[model samples]
Target: MAWGITKKITSAVKKSAKGKATTASASALMAQREEARRTLLKAKGTWSQYDGHLVRGRQFLADVVEQKKTAHTDGTHTQADGELVDIDAYSHAFDDTPNRYSASVLELFLVQKGLMENSQGETYRGPYHFNSATAVVTGNPAQSAAVQDMMEVLKNNEGAEGGSRNHASAMTIEDMRKVMAWSYKQCPDELISLIYSRVQSESALDMDNVILAQKHLVIRAFATTGFTIWTRNFELTKIRRKDIVWNCQGCPPYDIPYDLLQDHEYEIYPQQQTPEICMFTHLRAWVNFLEEVLLRRPLEPDEFIFARVGANSVVYASDQLSYDGVMKMLAWMCKEVGLTARYTTHCFRRGGARYRFMFTPLGQRWSLATIRWWGAWAEGESKNHRDALCPIPREGDKSFNGDHILTAPITAAETQELKMSFDHELNCLSGKVEEVLDKLTLAPASSTYSSPLPAPSQPPILVSSPQSLQPTLCHQATISPFLESASTPSMIPSPVPVDSTSSPSPPAFPTTRALPSSSRQHGTTAKKAAPIPGVGIPDLPRGPEAWRTAVKQWEDPAASIGGKALKDWPEEWYTGPMRTITGVKRNIRKVIAMEFYRLQRDEAIFVEAYPEATCGVKPLFDAVQRQREGRSEITRRATYITLSRPAVAGTTFPGPTRALAQLYLFIRRHSVLVH
Candidate 1:
């Protein structure tokens, strides 16, 4: 029996030794693998580890490397050339380092202050928080003993808290709330209950709460709703309240609520009742009112978050204040209490606009069904389903039709007149009255067909003087000089007449007429005259012989001179893309249509503008071709011009365009003419 027991004990000892050896070997192998992963991560770059495990670190590193390799292979990494890389292996190797923020917290002793609590149910403030023993307390005498003690400590620590120290400012309403909210986690139950009580009472007006609310709205509107408020022209109603409707079947709603609020057209101002204005600007107004009536210490130029009270002024006018004055206020308020990177009011406008689309109903945007139902997407279709749809305002650009100002806060009659004016402006051709009339007669109802019905005609308007219709004629006069200069070279000296009966009086087009005595100096007046045939006045010599003898070859008024009015125009000129068109055919057709129409429009505008030039097509063609080739020279040119142009000056196009147009005409026309 003794011998058998001994044998069993011996066997057990041997097995234990083998198991220990295996465990050591495994641990060593793991350590070596971890080291190797770290090395690889260091090699690949951009590897950072969050969690604290060697294995996890290596895995994260490897993931990063794999991502990097994939990016390289997929042409996403600009620096990487095509190479078969072990993406997974690279990722596993790189994710090993600790986070910088976590390290900063430790270094700054933030966690200690974060965890500290007082018997009065108060907690240690963040880095910005000063103990009664340290701070120089001001403003309210009702501060607690704890706060007093904090101030005392701040006095002793004045060396650390300098006058210019950014973090030394008092806690904002927003920062205090954030700290209290965050404090609840580490706080004892009794302290937490007290904090909640303080919050409930709302007696303590903290900057943190205001900032928190603004941030919450920004997140909700921009990050979640995927829709944003485009225009904030209202003082009373700033909230973007456009919601998407599911089964909405009525006429589209306008943004009139906000518009009216802005214009103060409503009886006694509905900003108080309007929900959109109620959201943002009202808070500012309330704050301003409080500061005036209660606080007595009015807001400074940079103190308020919204444009109310003292905060309302342009940055240039403010002189000393920054453009983002509200942001600075919010930051000062938030950081003092312990929060970071809080938002301001303007953040909502941009943020909301960006994300508003996400919350919109799927078919809210102009689509095939919308086009069919509306006959055309004339900016009103977005309002069709108002309940659940928030339509993003399509802003105006050189390319697309933007928000119609016709829907703004004018009377219905005024709106109608405005609409008529808008239609006339859009419908009219660019030239003399007779030329415009002739063009209108030839123009098709839709540009897609060759011999379509003619566009609607208005009674012939006169071309009296430049200022006859409108006294100033500022808009027209702005472009007149360029046209005049362009036509200079085309000028031909009147043939020296043989007789005196040649020239009639230079067509007595009336001059731009002045307004009545009661009318304001710069005000406009309507004038009427018979339409002249050709725009450019053929400069005739003073003698009657000039007009009679200078080759009066009458041409037919109805002659087709390849003026590119509207024959077989592209379909895209009238409609957006076709919905049912599928696959490559759809893409190709649409691309071709867009390209062709762009080319045609550009060609027509340039050719008509510079008729004397031979290679008029070259500039337009090159510009369009580069666009099609994705070379993007036009954008670069525009961006460059924008960058180079003076900020407080005239239009960008008129300057460079005039120069380039002249250059093109001079080179193409003069060069060919000389040759």
Candidate 2:
């Protein structure tokens, strides 16, 4: 009957899982259909102003030309009128005066100031008045000839020079490399973490590194898709999968505008970034991170794409990020990446165009016509538009050698060499930063604990393993002085010697999330695992009598995980270094839960929220007292055999003719020690 009930529960769980899958699949289908609808709108070329003809009068009146040229008295843009202005206009001024009356006092001022006038020396012949105090544009062009000429000129110039650059500077692969280097710097991890002495470029991070990945994911997507789309910065801000209103501004292309991608929908990083700098990979990663991991739910249509993320993780996706905010970040990236060219949002369009026109391999290069259309340039727009955005580099001396990057495709070997060199530079710089930060955060600690080099007299300090040192009752009596900066000198567990023949220490349980287990130790190819101390847990139930002593550790594993109240710990633990430490005395409870591991030299910190989480030497000896107070030999022997220090004193069960459990335990300990 019990088995049958268990099966029924299992069936219900499976059905629930099936229901969830169905819901997710439906979301995906809805998103796909929404994307299809958007694609149709883009193909039609005026999605924002759909059915706008109906909004204006559908009937063709005698003054149809005037009706079309001028906006409605209610202030609305027509479909054709919206098309006449550049699509980028939606980002800046969605509402504006009718195109016919667009010649404003401000326009006259700018034109008079030499900022807005045509460089070809053409003037607006239409009526306008400019005095020193104020300027006014002509309201009514009663003379039909001047209006027609002005209208024709305006029509010819729409979207012609909107995103064009004067001194065109394309972002080369080297520039992208710098941006990527900057991205790695932003992401604190084994890859570019200050803590690690060496970093591996080729080594991939697990998709499960949710917190670590999210911090960098925002900036990475900004850099990657920012280049790939070649869109305006404001358009880049519209990269929401589920954004409602402006989703159809232009294509990044069209996955995000309707709603976020559903659960299990997007790929993780390193899966696609084989070159260590891939646009598609980072873009997908950023989107996926928002939905599946950071938010832990599909984003609403109104959510921010790059939510307020910090060094830790996403803070919120509440507010719409402004273009000025984005531009400010772009400015920072330009400065930090060491690009001499002051890049605006226009650089993305310009740089991408240059790659298509000149840098791409000859046979695969984009045609001038395709480039024009791809960039939303209108018909009859020629080579000069692309040339202005993506001009060939000319030497100071006007030598043709300046265009060498355009003529020659870099060999794969050269690219790889460059990547490795960047990796080396990243490691050196990040490693130094880690050192400085370690010193900065640990600055409050006394000099004795903050010292870098271990005194020559002391034994080489093993970080976690007290078994490696025979003299300790604790897991580790002291960390190396450099690692000690994270904590004050007092919290270091004072030694309380245990019987040499006593039980082995339990493996340290980390407050921080566990890194992927690695064969590589510190200062190796892989990332260094956070310096977790090998501390013994309070209640292992040394004897059968001790089992029912309200040792509620296994009852709720997480309760003890953060650390039980200081009152709950053995009285002996209240003695020694723990008693002396002011930090431990202040806290009521020990909470070992860490949002993220610290980036410093090798050491585990008894951080805020969990001051006394670090297992001290006195606690180990206190636990041993449980073994000596056995009610019977059966319980006593069991306790001794179960927790016995395996390497030196293997489980003393039936001696030479050992129990299978004892032999297995013996073998396991040997294997651990060997590693």
In TM-score terms, which candidate is top? 2
lDDT of 2 by residue, 460-555 (tens): 222222233332221111222122222221222333467879964322211112222231244433333342121123332333323222223323
Report how far residue 8 has shifted in candidate 1, in Å. 99
Residues 1-675, candidate 1: write the lDDT tens digits: 334545654786799866753355888768855665665445423344323344443444445456677657753333235534444333323333544323332432333334442322334233233348877543334355677799988767765655233232222323323543433332223322232344445544334333343333322222111112232222212221122111222223443222221121111112232233223333333333334322345544334223322322221211322335434544654565455443444433333333333322233333444332222224544433222222333334422322463354656665565566544543341222222112111232333323211232332221232212322211111122323222212231232335576753221113223212331222342343322111111222223232121122112212111112112323432222211111112222223234444446364553354332233322333333345334331122221112111121111112223243223322222222212
Q: How do the predictions measure up, each by TM-score?
A: 0.16, 0.29
Show where candidate 2 strays beyond 4 Å: 1-169, 186-215, 243-277, 292-294, 307-318, 361-364, 369-373, 378-675
| Candidate 2 TM-score versus the reference | 0.29
| Lowest lDDT 10-residue stretch of candidate 2 | 587-596
RMSD value for candidate 1: 32.1
Q: Rate the local accuracy (lDDT) of all candidates.
A: 0.32, 0.42
Candidate 1 stretches greater than 4 Å from native: 1-324, 330-347, 360-675
Clashing residue pairs in candidate 2 are 241-256, 242-256, 242-259, 242-301
Listed per candidate, the RMSD to the true structure in angstroms reads 32.1, 25.1
Whose lDDT is greatest here? Answer: 2
